[model samples]
Target chain A: MPDDQLSRVFAALADPTRRDIVGRLAVGDATVGQLAAPYDVTVQAVSKHLRVLEDAGLVSRTRDAQRRPCHLEAEVFDLMTKWIERYQRQAEERYQRLDAVLARLQDDEQQQTDPDEGAAS
Target chain B: MPDDQLSRVFAALADPTRRDIVGRLAVGDATVGQLAAPYDVTVQAVSKHLRVLEDAGLVSRTRDAQRRPCHLEAEVFDLMTKWIERYQRQAEERYQRLDAVLARLQDDEQQQTDPDEGAAS
Candidate 1:
């Protein structure tokens, strides 16, 4: 996905209601009425959230007029998963490198403090 | 992290500049001036981005007088990773169940079409 679409996906999921909607959709497809029934919000409000999700490619509504069920597009989650894992892995590797450096420094300090012991060994 | 903080984190990363800052910080910590050097925007703008990141617990700025470098707090990524993976797993399982149901239906259809073959076998 392009950076713009990724931004849109993040922005779309930033809302608690929208995230809840996505969670519900993950279990099964639901119409706007079904989705809005749990929340006190109006159907229009829920529709707006669905619109954002649709725009972000996270959700898609079936064209059936009577029952326009919103389906969770699971593939879009891969885009976010990939982006987040990239940075997370990089940060982890950096920490591992730092740990190795610290360990080396401690070894050097130990050798300096017991030079005679090191030579005997 | 709470839902509010997760929202904040998602909102913080919605901007391309903020995501870029995060990607840079993943490599190593950098002062606001250093982070803003590559962008056309002013240091103040970058500081604002960092503020959002800090609010979300994704980045922390050291209190050093010479350079308040921003460090990436990698733990917060776990919250998002967990959230995304939960829904992704649910959706995947749902698809798998649907595929199984379809496969059963296909087997049933095949058995009906070749009733004599099944009896012989």
Candidate 2:
């Protein structure tokens, strides 16, 4: 529970139910009742989940006359994607560098262990 | 809060400090003391964060004699990326479909409203 939007966004999606609701909303916008129907949870429970999503700016509620529909803000996904990709790419690059360094070290060790092995063979 | 691996991963990364630690570990593995040196918090606090990351399988600590070094499990990043990509793609497709439908409806409306106007002009 960090206060930042990225933290909030990741925190909001930590729940399976909330993630499922997001999946359903991605297909189409739905009312809280409609979103809640598939789960065993109550409408209030689903509304609570929606509140978390809304707080994270991942979901927005629009007044459709008497009913309010929850719309998925897919653009927010870009924030999470960017964060994840930055670290993922950095980690992969580091791994590659580590691999190269290890390979060179292995070659150096071999050269030191048997300086004349190449000529003998 | 959820028991699933995806939930655990997202929940573990929800804290800013935890995410920062993950970023650092991504560059290379380090001892707990080494990891804690940069932060103002106690080593115990950093250990707690490491434990959360370890529980989520984003990191692993290997025993090298008495010292355990924390290594980033880069593969776990794939889970989060896949989940995010699936929903992001779905939502984008839905948005496109909605756009097409709206455009068609607008055209139909114009045709209905001015069926004779086009011919008259």
Candidate 3:
């Protein structure tokens, strides 16, 4: 898939099934068959979902006999968390600035307080 | 085009250009031409990208003469936040349970403890 890491991660998680698989893997590592047992989908389909999760770096697999047990990599959660926090903070900051601007405008209409628009109150 | 909301949102954000546009919109409402100015891409392509964001409910445009200043609907961020937090929380909960299981296993192997796999001590 032609995607950035963020895209890969978001697209990987866009599926409810893949999110569930990640959920199960987080509790403990499990073989593909074990992961597939709860879902009605074929093993191959679940395998594909795991592949997407793997590509997103959300999950990793190790061999044990013929089974490939998948494990969740918690570190990748930080990537999404950081991205979300950054934008959320920015949006909130913008909202606060807008509020200040509106207050200043109201003050100007009243001709009451001489607030410096550029100053951070 | 034939995509679920989650898919549409992801595909809309798959482009870095679109993400930048969204970031700028989060800061303040801007017209299509203003959004398109920073990039080398044609305004038509940027308009197409805005259409994607609009369909995803990330951006909303309203009439201002011939201009449609795009506003970021902050509620949409909650949609993504909810999705991300659900998976992230589930993953963290799973990790805690796994830690308990592993500790139980280690204890079983250690002091000749009767570690019932089904029972929690």
lDDT of 1 by residue, A1-121 (tens): 2348999999998999999999999989999999999999899999999999999999999877787899999999898989999999999999999999999999998878798777888
Interface RMSDs of the predictions, in order, are 2.1, 0.7, 2.5
lDDT (C-alpha) at residue A61 in model 3: 92
Each prediction's total of clashing residue pairs, residues at least 3 apart in sequence or on different chains, is: 0, 0, 0
Q: What does the i-RMS of model 3 come to?
A: 2.5
Give fnat for candidates 1, 2 and onward, in order: 0.87, 0.90, 0.45
Better of 1 and 3 by lDDT: 1
C-alpha lDDT score of every prediction, in listed order: 0.92, 0.92, 0.81
Every model's TM-score? 0.86, 0.93, 0.81
**Weakest lDDT window of 10 consecutive positions for candidate 2 chain A:** A112-121
Best DockQ among the predictions, by candidate number: 2
Docking quality class, candidate 3: acceptable
Residue-wise C-alpha lDDT for candidate 2, range B12-96, written one tens digit per residue: 9889998999999888899999999999999999999999999999999999887789999989989999999999999989989
Pairs with steric clashes in candidate 2: none
**Model 1 interface Cα RMSD in Å:** 2.1
Candidate 3 yields a Cα-based lDDT of 0.81
Q: Which lDDT value does model 3 have at B6? A: 63
The DockQ values of the predictions, listed in order, are: 0.58, 0.85, 0.37
DockQ of 1: 0.58
